[model samples]
Target: MKRILTAIVLIAIVVSLVLLGKLWMITLLAGAIAVLAALEYRTISAAMKSPVPMWWTIGAIALFFLAVFLRPQDTITAVVFSTLVLFAWNALATGVDRVLGETASGVLLLVYIAYPLTLLPQIWSLENGTALLLFLFLCVWCGDIAALYVGKNFGKRKLAPTLSPNKTWEGAIASVVAAVGFGMALIALGNWLSTNGSGYTRLHTSAPWWEYVLLAILLNIAAQFGDLLESALKRGAGVKDSGTLLPGHGGVLDRIDALLLAAPVLWFVWVVKEYFSLGSF
Candidate 1:
């Protein structure tokens, strides 16, 4: 428990510093994290006897880089084509490797790790990008913290006993509560800043409180799914904690599992709202 708390504090400090320092720093850090996560995914797939080709992994990483640095308008098409080609190539290589499940595994890896992560750069480049990113981080982090605390204290019904026995309905309730609190706090803070003429406000005044609430709820749900998704992967791979990449915390993948799922969902919602002129309500 002490170790977990200490790790959380250290992570918070590091994240705060990075967020305050430079935008490029955040991008670089996210890119490096994505690479590490991709490697972890590859390792898990290989261990599960899911044969992902070396060439496919390389190509996926290349696509990741292209998605991150290049603001190409055709990025979505490029990503789809790249993923398809990688899967097709893996299918072709099945004869050499004699693996039955390589195609499915390769496809999973590309979509789960690469495609969702591509949204990070897009979120960073939005008009209110920084606030949106911060909101994402908060939603995921708060959800996780709430789940942990509530699960420890009041967890009676297991949410998914097979994949993750530790998760519980009580934890899920706590997660939603925490998400709501965090969202409302952000709204209040934004309102305060806007009224005071402070520069820290990033959310638009036109954006409604209900939007934050909806976003928070969606983010919480996504975070839960993300954690479960990883749990399912780990169970299938017959391993624990992705890797021992972090001290006290399981691994980078474990720590950022919620963020991995929530980030893209948030970005997608924001994009859809913007495109359709939803008026932030």
Candidate 2:
């Protein structure tokens, strides 16, 4: 019950933000999430004996989101470069014994946690951005729910025993199926709205069905990997949940870990389709 309620509230908030279709608003929300996730990442890194500076990590993450919000084109190159420079300087200031571990963890905090999330607003700024954002959310959310139920009831063969003992191949397969099904349904609804002149112009109603299916598959795979990636991190850090920020969920990081990878995959596809004039997908 608690988990269901939390999921409902999160869905509502995300839908409201996407519907508003404002870049800054979405960036602001993403920024808050990034900060919280970074905080959790800091703790996890510390637990693994690779402690990164909390203030530096938070600052870099903030700058990453801000850069993406203000200048999407060169945000990654600029922010990541500056962040590395800071990490190098810090290494010089402190001792160099744990430099490799600390620096690597800092970089992971930026590239893994901060960079991919900045793509949310970028995805929103694309053509049919609102619909795209909602589609991404729906697919991931449906996959997560399906994986949970399927894994618990029918899971036998472990997917990755070292990283996450509970996950199973059965659950992973079900997640992909559920994500693709929900994605197609959403696309169908968009087609209906477009045909009926429902005033919902944020959807890409003309794309071929197969393209959307392929996208759903790609996103589902990415999301699954994202979940496994977080699980590996937690396992390495010797913790179960990332943090207790979200009741029945874990932490902001635990919740958005999938998006950490899934968002960038969508953004890359959007870029290729738009910038390269692919005209589809």
lDDT of each: 0.75, 0.85
- Candidate 1 — which residues are off by over 4 angstroms? 1-10, 13-23, 53-59, 76-100, 203-205
In terms of lDDT, the poorest run of 10 residues in model 1 is 91-100
Tens-place lDDT digits, model 2, residues 105-152: 888888898888888887787667777888899789999889999999
- What lDDT does candidate 2 reach at residue 122? 76
Prediction 2 global C-alpha lDDT: 0.85
Deviating ranges (above 4 Å) for candidate 2: none
- Clashes per model (N, Cα, C within 3 A): 0, 0
Candidate 2, residue 15: Cα displacement in angstroms equals: 0.7
Per-residue lDDT tens digits for candidate 1, residues 156-218, read 999999999999999998998898898678667767876786766555445777878888999
Model 2, C-alpha of 222: deviation from truth (Å): 0.9
Residue 39, candidate 1: Cα error in Å is 1.1
